[model samples]
Target: MLFSSLLFIFQFLPVFFIIYYLSPIRFRNLILFLASVFFYAWGEPRFVILILISILINYIAGIFIERYDRNEKIRVTILVLSIIYNIGTLMFFKYFNFIIENINYIFKGDISFIDIPLPLGISFYTFQIMSYTIDVYRRDTKAERSYINLGAYLCMFPQLIAGPIVVYTQVSKELRKRSYYLKDIEKGLRIFILGLGSKVLIANNVGGLWDDMAQIGYANISMPLAWLGLLSFSLQIYFDFNGYSLMAIGLGKMLGFDFPQNFNFPYISKSVTEYWRRWHITLSTWFKEYLYIPLGGNRKGKLRTYINLFIVWSVTGLWHGASWNFIFWGIYFFVLLSLEKLFLKKWLEKNVILSRIYTILAILLGWMIFAITELENIKIYFGRLFSFSISEDWIYYLRNYGMILVIGILFSTPFLKKWYDKQANKILCNILLLVIFLLSIAYLVDAAYNPFLYFRF
Candidate 1:
């Protein structure tokens, strides 16, 4: 159930909102939990059981961890078991086939691959569960005694699919007690509409341009056209994921739960370090908190810090997908970030224009690595991007998609948002939002090239 689809927008959301607001305060969590389960089951009914099992395991584990808090070894053991259960389930469904295929290739063994369907949002919910158990073990948060509250927090439909990776402690209070207000509803609606417009009007349309260019074979594409195509993909991916994050946050607000912001105009970042700080802020924070910091972080000195970064990034890339190219994409940023930390940071800071150019080019090239999975195709595409070849098709695509590219680039910065915020009389602003909403509806109705890019992750 995509948020942009008419079925979700016109049917599921309206029904859920009405029932939720009308329900008695005491039963609200029950209402939300039921709705979330239904929403998850709507796409893949079988996976509901899998998710239920996960919630049950983590819920019970949290209680046991709290009960055994006086016994450090037992508490730690429970936490380890919970983590293993969550990650093992994720690996079985998401990475089992990936591992088997690689094994067969390496050893020339006939390993029969298991055909497992990845449950929707397994990556997201698994991490959420792990965070809860770990927090309990560390005594950072009390174990959630109410299964209903725990289930609601873990399976809330808005952030369940693709997430800002909400930690348990962040929303524990809201799960137990929350309030709704007219102002919150208004704010939430405005944010939701803005995200809808970004996804429909900007992301989907530019995604089509990228698809068209990709159909032009990599070998035949000229350098300029290759760059244009990759640029289009870069825009499409940013708007798609960021737009989804905004919609999730907006919905969270409407439900009287505060979700963290996931993006912060990352394209404007002048360094790879800065870019990671801004882009997918929640995911980066998760790795830093759960993985990097635990691995001694910078406290262990320079060599260990670099080693920690390598491990974190390698896993980060694998988290994105079960592909070698994604791993390369991770290492690609690792190299750039390492250089910046070692020496490039000083030089980049001294030259503003050059720094921006370098950052943009580096990010653009990284997108190219991310956009394709096959090594052969990636090699050919890179050849096209750097071959200095010329073709008429590049001009044709530019003429068609030039304005959209301009709009995408502009929105990637804070220019439009700053302008919107400066308006004192919000009548014009409201009117603009209405226009965007209507335009988004028209696009959704047409249902052209609408894909949630991060759902695979």
Candidate 2:
């Protein structure tokens, strides 16, 4: 169920929270596990089995890995089997159709497509399981012995669907022993309300602008309109995903777990390298830790480092979706990042205004690539973006969405957050939050144009 949906917000959450806190401390995990399973089953009844299979496989594998730690061969074999099972399951469900279509296209064969329904959050939970098994193999963290704790961790509904990709080690302690504090609950509630406002007030509203522009057709779009559409899209994606991350983190806090922060003010960065560090911080860290570092990373020398980046980014793009355009989007960033590492970083550092302009333009262009999937459509849209043309429709949209665009841009930076931090007006803060909450509720009640863009991923 979507966190923004009234069913979830009004019914499921209230009921779950009441039951969760009322239960004895010992039965808390059991309650959470059952509730999470129900939550997943509510949307994906058949595919809930897939998640259970994953939990069982990883849970057993972790124990075996720990049991056979003294035997190098047995331990390695178990770890390798666990990785294969997790990745193979993910590949089959998420990429099997993608692979078959590509094969048919290349060989001109009539391969029957496997019409498999991708289990919701398969990509996320698969990675979480793999991380746990790998950590167990490396002896970085102890294998979780309790099936209940591990199951709850894997199926935790808050971050389960879309994730900061919570690692097993991060919440292992909390899973075993955690306490509820009034201050933490209050803080979490505040963060949750802020995130709700961001998604409902900013992301959903601006996204409608992009949707309207898209319906007008790419070929007919003028240069200014193209940029405007892209700007709306960039803001829409940022606020949507970042808002979800904040809600997940806040929910984690309320449950007495501390999930890591997923995003910083990435749009404020002056370099592509800096942007990656701030944007989707957890996923980037995952690739660096599990993929890049293992592939010899920068320690292997300059050329190998570039090759490693290429491999990482190619996979990263594919991870986002099963599409060629996503791959191109990844490579596009790879090229920009490589150039920055080579010499652009030095040049950008010397000129502040120029660097900001370059970074923003680069990001805007990248979003253009990421937003469109078909090659022909990409060509047409980009042609318009650079055509230096204008139309009356561009002016119309500007007149309509100018204030929202301004607000989106301002919120992209840390201006409001910094201002709020300096204020000692607790009452003022509460009042503002209440206003935002009420506005969000009104939007939710109307339910006009709410879209969670990253739901597929």
Candidate 3:
């Protein structure tokens, strides 16, 4: 269930955390594992079995890899097979229909596309599973002896669906030994409340403006409104995903597991390369560690480095979805990042304001590509964005959404966060947190547009 949903916030989470806190230390891992399975099953019951397959396959593979460590060939073979299994299952469920449709279009063949359902969080949890096996293969970490501990690590509900993409190493120790503290619970609750405000108060409210533009038709929108609408979406996606990440981190904190930071005020970045460093950080770390470095990261040569980037970006694009637009989005960034690496880096670094403008504009256009799936609609939208057309229609939306947009813009940087930190322990700040919590709950009570955007990925 969605973390923001009233049912999850009020019912499932409360009941589960109560059981979790009351459970004895020895049985905690088992309780967490079972609760996680139930959580996943609540939304995708059939897929739970498939995910169980993943857990067992990887878990067993880790053990075998560790067991056969003296035999390089055997260990390597197990690792390769496990990788193939994880990637193969991900491809079949996520991209089978995507591949079939493309094939039908190209070859004039009527291949009836099977109705396949993607398992919930397959993209996320699969990466975590593969990381564990690969680390064991690399001797970076030992394979866990306890099946229940591994199960809980893989299935923990907090970062299970949308993640900071916690690697197995990050939580292996916590699985083996962890302690609960009242301070951790209070701090986690506070962080969660702020994230709720970010998603519900700011992201959801501004997101409606974009939806309105879509319904109103991009063709009829003036150039100014097109930019505004895209900005709204930019804010919507950032806060939506980042807010979800924060909530996940907070939940992790409460459970005595420290998850990695996912975002770092990416909008403040002056370059796309820097932007990436701050945005979806764990995913970047994953690609860098497992894929890029293995492929010989920049230690090779400039030409090879560019080629390496191309491969990473191509895979990164496909990883987001089984769509050409996502591919284009990846290539778009690849080109920009490549240029920055080649010549523009020096100039962009010196000119902060101009670089930020350039970075944000480039990011917004990239989002435009990401926002639309159909090429024709994408063309029309871009045309509107730059047609230089004038209309007073934008004024109406600006009036309606201006304040939330301002709030989103401010929060996207570190300004609000720094200010909050400065006043963190003050009575006013505490009251503000309470008000945010109460308002978020009220919004969820009557919520309309509360979808967590990254769940599809």
lDDT (tens digit, per residue) of candidate 2 on 1-457: 8777788889998999999999898988888999999999998899888888899999999999999989999999999998999989889988998899999999998889878988888888888889999999999999989898999999999889889799999999899999899999888888888888888999998888788867999999899999999999999999999998888888889999999999899999989999999999989999999999999999999999999999999999999888899999999999999999999999999998889899999999999888888989899999999998877779999998899999999999998998777652488888898898899999999976777888788
* TM of each candidate vs. truth: 0.99, 0.98, 0.98
Clashes of each: 0, 0, 0
Residue 221's C-alpha lDDT in candidate 3?
94
Cα-based lDDT at residue 350, candidate 2:
95
Determine the C-alpha RMSD for candidate 2 after optimal superposition of all C-alphas.
1.0
Taken over the whole model, the C-alpha lDDT of each candidate is 0.91, 0.90, 0.92
Clashing pairs in 1: none
Alpha carbon lDDT at 109, candidate 1: 89
Point out where model 3 deviates above 4 Å.
none
lDDT of 3 at 99: 92
Root-mean-square deviation (CA) per prediction: 1.0, 1.0, 1.0
Query: Which candidate ranks first by lDDT, i.e. highest?
Result: 3
Residue-level lDDT for 101 in candidate 2: 92
Q: Report the Cα lDDT for candidate 2.
A: 0.90
lDDT of 1 by residue, 1-457 (tens): 9988899999999999999999899899999999999999998799998888888999999999999778999988888898888889888898999999999999998989877887888889888889999888888999999888899998999999999899999999999888899898888888899899889899998887778866777888889999899899999999999999999998999999999999999999989899999999999999999999999999999999999999999999989888999999999999999999999999999999999999999999999888898989999999998998886888888998999999999999998899998862489999999999999998888776788999988
On lDDT, who's better, 1 or 3? 3
Q: Order the candidate numbers by lDDT, best to worst.
A: 3, 1, 2
